[model samples]
Target chain A: MYVGFPHMGNAHIGIRGLFKALGILTIDLPPVNRLTVELGAKYSPECSCLPFKTVLGNYIQALEKGADCLIMLGGCGPCRFGYFGNLQEKILRDLGYDFKMIILEPLDWRQTLRQLQETFSPVSWKQLIYASRLAWGKTVAADTIESFSHFYRARQSRPGIITGIYQRGLEKIDKAYDLASLRTIVKEVEGEMKAAVLPFEPEIKIALIGDIYTLIEPYVNYQTDLKLGEKGVQVERSIYSSRWLKENFIPWEKKKKRRKMLRDAKGYLKNMVGGHGLDTIANAVRYSREGFDGIIQILPMTCMPEIVAESILPRVAEDYQIPIMSLAVDEHSSDTGLQTRLEAFIDLIAQRKKDKKDYFLSKVHEAS
Target chain B: MKTKIGIPRALAYYAYYPMWKTFFEELGCEIVLSPETNKEILDLGVKEAVNDACIPIKLFHGHVSSLQGKVDYIFLPRLISMNTERTVTFCPKFLGLPDMIAALDTDLPPLLDMRFDFKKGKKQGFKGFYEIGKQLKHSYWAIKKAFQNALHAQYEYEKLLAQRVTVQEALAYLYEGKELSKPVDYSLKFAVLGYPYAVHDRFLSVDIINQLRKMGVTPLTADMVSSKRLAAQAQKLPKDLFWTFSNQVIRAALYYLDEEKVDGIIHVTAFGCGPDAMVDKLIELEAKARGHVPFISISVDEHTGEAGVQTRLEAFVDMIKLRREQ
Candidate 1:
């Protein structure tokens, strides 16, 4: 059983597919949101967010799905997500949810020899490598198709239908497992899809900021990019196909380009300015420079990075004269209210562009 | 001859360095700290710390490793529980740090666990640092005198602080023999409630003072808050506080929120503390529900790289700004 939070916007189906392909029983969890929060809060210790929700949710969900060993995802950067597995295991065990947990800390090149020795000692190298590759491929496929769907949904005509078609085509391409063939599929189908979403000459451009997973994944964030695209907005995300490739693969050493996967998260972690905070600010500056009409910052309720971006983003918006809206999502997040606010924000941007005036807008509704 | 004491420049480093540095120096011992929390040091921490441990705990290990060859003794404060009641505790990683660092860094110096309450005296008793001093071959009187001087300096520092002098500023006044007066109205006090180190470290990733000063917001360190006082505040929540530091953090936030008269609160914790992970949502929810005042939670780790911490501080300031504007 693999436990996950809506930490990022990753769809579990593809990941589950990889697990199943590896001859393992995989349970796909219900998309995380406010409901997951309630369930997680009910059983989880009082304070932890991703862990509380994920541990309890994974336990109950996996238990419901009749899982054996509980596996959770992890990272070693700003989010503090790395410790979730151990912490979750302890908390759940105390509550009578007995299960095993796997926390795959990102490889640090310096510690590679030792970390790998420990990691590979437990699992077969073939299975590990295969699982990793599948995950990597799926991340790209999910991110790209999800973005394409979102783009077509909000900004294009007949968003719901056109995006559905685009997603279907993208999925077919993903299953190909080969880049050339997939590219061929896209070359053949993309022209018709782009033609379908017409009036693309001067659509409003929106840059997403906050919580890399939420901004990238469609399942958790409700295909926000697709929704915006169908509504006639050009969705730009910091995560791209090439960057993921460069980070994951570029063969290092005598092969010319560095081919070895970066063992350390130093580049990503020590960046200090990355995470959602750096990503959002950098993207905000980039979007503003690109003359983007607006920016949307999305993150979890307890995230620290987005909270930081929330402070400086207003200044960024002011400087660029671009409208910005930030949303902190949790289980209590209401779809209707969220959509209403997004709609209002979009309208505000469209209105500001027409009037060329300073139009301050807010999506944040204080509990008070 | 002065025995050298190694203080790792990590977690507890940011929190009690001044007190530790001054007290140890006053004892005529050489104080050497592991270099500032950086990539190399943090990597060392991750290597030495338990695989499942939080980044801070891992970093603490790296700090210990760095100080091993250089110092005769390395200080790893094993404060088990500070609250009177068994309700307050620290993260599991903190509780087991001595064994963890010792296991990983075999080349490390004898771990000096300045543990306040690890034994029966783990919660409600005075720590016999005099015994620790004797173990380090220092005369009990010298240890007592050094402790007394350090304690006095800390108390006087607090007096100056109550007059609105910061730790750094008070240090200056004490060192330079200058009279100190607060320029700002000790008004608009915001509690810096979290782990002690993250709040105190001026140069590391999250510069809370600069963050506060940038917006004219007065920052208060959580260290000023006693955990026993905060633990009394934690009675509202029904659960065992296993992680002692987190217990203090919880109590501090709640006490400041309901009783300390803080206008708002900011909780800075190592991003992955289980004890804190156990409580952040409750803080957010509590801050939201009964909050006439707001709470801003910040997570700091070596990975924070400061710029990210700054962004969060800026965002938190904006939230405060928006609230004040309204």
Candidate 2:
């Protein structure tokens, strides 16, 4: 049973192949879909979005296939992914499902190195290096393929062509026996996808805000991009991969925060004043300023940090006149209602746009 | 020269509203209640509150926003503690509501931060109330008399209810020209037991009474219990009561069982409500041990959806029916 990455940069490309090499019984399902979102939402709570429901739906799908253990990625950030695991466990338990949940918490460089040393058993650098290289290669392949597909989906004139194309491409990549074959297929598909150009439509935009995991993870978020793309909506999702953040962005942020944020007073008060961190508010404000359609605030259920974000979402909605539909995505959330809410919100967005247009026209008429 | 005071139909409303109401009236200050919450009020709350706030905090915003400029000052009672142990410290939101209110867009009257210290019984709590009354220009003797009369009025009101009397029956003695007790064809027991704000805020759990009645269950509120006795029983939980109101709910559950044992208890809490997180668990455990009492805990936050709640209530009722047949 080869398991796919739960979400985002974790497409589990090489990871699944490695499991096969290690004789691990791993099975990968087709990534999450809207129906999966619907099913999850039906049985789930309303505070959640499609992604939370989709991921649980994915796991439920996985369990039907005889998988015993469920593993989820973990991280600590403003979004509240850290505590979602505990809630997910409770939710699954509430539904009478039990399985092992291995939570892989994000680690610093030193810890990562130490973990690698431990996984090597008897501490051989060569074996660890080889494993690392193999995983890295698979990741590159997965990222490239997935990105190409997502990009294609975004640009395609047709609503759902890329989803099918990616489905075919994923099967092709999965069937490859060796890295050479995988690389060869990737090269072939990459060329083909690159050639399949899409139309440029920058009219309606939707900003995805929440924990980074649910935003980018196809498995977790139920391939929300596909749904958005199918609707011919341009999506701008928050991209804060934990690995990327720790390696590339964290130091820069720490340095900036230390100089500007010694005590929590600035950060705390900013959140205290606005109800989430000031930065998130600023980011949403920036999105508003950039003239995005509307801000979609999403996060896991029972998450505290994101509560701060939820508290001030109305302010953003009020100030920007950009109807914000802040979603609290917990495991219990329903899919149909979420979709309906999103659809309703989009309807409001259209009306708001029309209202603005009418206002501008009326002003011009008055001047004439 | 007594200016009227306003009390929002919010936290501690169902519990101590009579006392607060009677007390104010005794002091010759007319009291006005903030309107019941609606979508407009909820939207106001959502707009006024921070994004990441608990449901009750949002509901509080709705309540406060409703009462803005309605009375001389909306009473934001900071009922810090009523007992020696401070057994319950409400969620940071409740403790900081005074500041929370100050942060709102509405021009709130200066808060009546009604701090209470029941360590030496009721002296300090009353003294705090007296100070507020004094500020309202009651004479030394008048304030004392008002407090005593308020206490008597509240006691009389509750005693009548405890005698299985209706609201009208209870008020017949309390209100001189009030109507006679007309027995409400409603007797469904549904302990809306939780921290003060979550239970009292209407927008958060809108149509609760109607919803319960629609299911043919007349809702019996836990707030109608004796707070002092209930607070004592609240200490029975695994985690010591840290918030004053949580203790009240725990004790209310106890009193409901030992006194007016209801068929079921619906423990309501705001989503991400810290106290109810532990308190609900304790109540469930304690309530379960006392026999086939069906208990359900419903957590509501800003994004509260109705479908699941309806299902849960239906399921809980079914479960209760099953137990009854057995």
Candidate 3:
């Protein structure tokens, strides 16, 4: 059976590695673009969130490319992400596509294991363990490379140098057959990124927080990170695929970091509003305390959790004396508008820094 | 003299007000319910609520604001589940209602945020209610007796709904302690599916029930169906929906479609509601494919106008009537 899954940033690399290790043929969907958005919007309900539309578009494209089975994550509500699997299945069936869907629901490992067993029949349990380890390694490697690229992009003297390196790094990771090679390539890439010469120090550091889908997917959020990096601002994102997997799937590790974030968020949000809402508030506070110049919250339009986060964010921003820009994106979110706002926000951060410096100088002069 | 406990007339307030009111009153607390949703309340809610929250959540903010200075404590329960089923859960906003209210930067009274989840059977629910009673300085026996009375009142309120009375009429009867006879059905019966807040709120829904009646259409809501019937209908799907209210709405729609008793279906969803987006699509697809039932979806928000709703309702009814004759 040929397997396919929706594109979530660099997750397909890990997923593809897992399927290959299990001796399964896999087809990866084409990268998200305007065409994908349009296709998804056409078949999707008018009000369905942007991520759903894009992912549905991805599935349709993959199926058209001869994928017979699809794998997707499932959620159990308070958010719309949980229902995407069921809704997409109905839509595809209504459109007369013949395919199978495997939804990996949280806390339902038995069902997931059963589905896995059925799909890869005659495979040993040891092979399953090997596949999972390889997949997890790929996820960690991809996130690391991406994070390093963010640092390089902000500091590199030449524009597009870091992106070129990132692309090549991803290609090498994809071609690597085992954990050893994957680790070697990741280390080599990190060394290369760090060795690159820098002409100037980064001016401002901003924390990127919000809905995971929009924050990670460049095409969905108009490549906000690259744009910010181009403007000489260092972007530090709170959520990454590996971190998310660790927090959700790994039971013991879930409490330590996330609990601290939640505790930090307690003064502002006070509850889990679902879908990274608490994360947004917590990260905003954490970033502010870490001396970050600004915070950017990017979420899809009409996203419930982020909306709740957005409401409480202003107070957090006021209390912490940090400037925050909340961007609610959808199919209609204009690139030019985003760029304009982002530029203005960066300029505001620079102005604030200078003003603080000047005020300190004045105080020192008065004391002397 | 007793402490005044404020209750917002939005979200689950339409469904569980009787139980909450009876319980608090039994504990010697005076209930101060925010007035029915009005423009001022709606505006306040809009202003205070997050920009992307649905109309009902915003209205809840409005109701809370209306009672801000008038009461000692706001009773906003974190209702996670009304059903014992593992998959069933309330909306995320409902789960986070008390926290959201507390974050609103208003000088509000302290909140008596109780949690209600029937996952571990009625024992957990009892523990929650008992905790609330304890906070109010009530004895264990008094709390137990009050809990029994609250349950009985809630059961009676639900009975009125099962007998086909609209929530508005049932609530009126509840307040007046009078029996409300079910109204006689009109010629064309239309199933109106939506969340309690969207269907019952006069301002948000623009009184769609009365508008349909004026247009000579009898409107049946999800509340009119029994939980057992809804559960049975829900079982027909491959997997039960994980949301409590969405499950009820979808099951009610399924019942109407499967029974083929209603001429058409009108689904009212709050603008930007996550679960309704899925449920609405499912109902629309089912209604069209299986029974060829005429389905109209109306989205309500702060910006929705009365004339547009009325015009659509009239047009939908007229088309159904025409189709019936044809």
Give the CA lDDT, 0 to 100, for residue A323 in model 2: 67
RMSD of every prediction? 18.4, 10.4, 2.0
How well does candidate 1 reproduce the true complex, by DockQ?
0.05
The CAPRI category of model 2 is: incorrect
Best by lDDT: 3
Instruction: Encode model 3's per-residue lDDT on A72-143: one tens digit a residue.
Output: 888776778887888899899999999989988786879887987787657778998999999999889999
Q: What is the TM-score of each predicted model, taking all chains together?
A: 0.51, 0.53, 0.96
Best by TM-score: 3
Best candidate (score: DockQ): 3
Local lDDT at B104 for model 1 = 49
lDDT of 1: 0.59
Cα-based lDDT for every prediction? 0.59, 0.61, 0.87
Ranking by lDDT: 3, 2, 1
* Chain A TM-score vs. truth, each candidate: 0.74, 0.64, 0.96
Q: Give a tens-digit lDDT track for model 1, residues A1-368.
A: 34332233444535654565455655556655555556676765433444346446646666556555665554443344544555566555655765555545444344444543443335577876776666566656555555565555554555466666666765664465544555566555556557667564545788876666566545446667766765677787866543544553455532332222121211221123223454566667666777888888877555544544454555566656778887766555677877888889889888877665333222223322
lDDT of 1 at A21: 49
lDDT, candidate 1, at B57: 63
Q: Candidate 3: list runs displaced more than 4 Å.
A: A255-258, B177-182
lDDT of 3 at B258: 82
| lDDT over C-alpha atoms for residue A246 of model 3 | 88
C-alpha lDDT of residue B107 in model 2 = 74
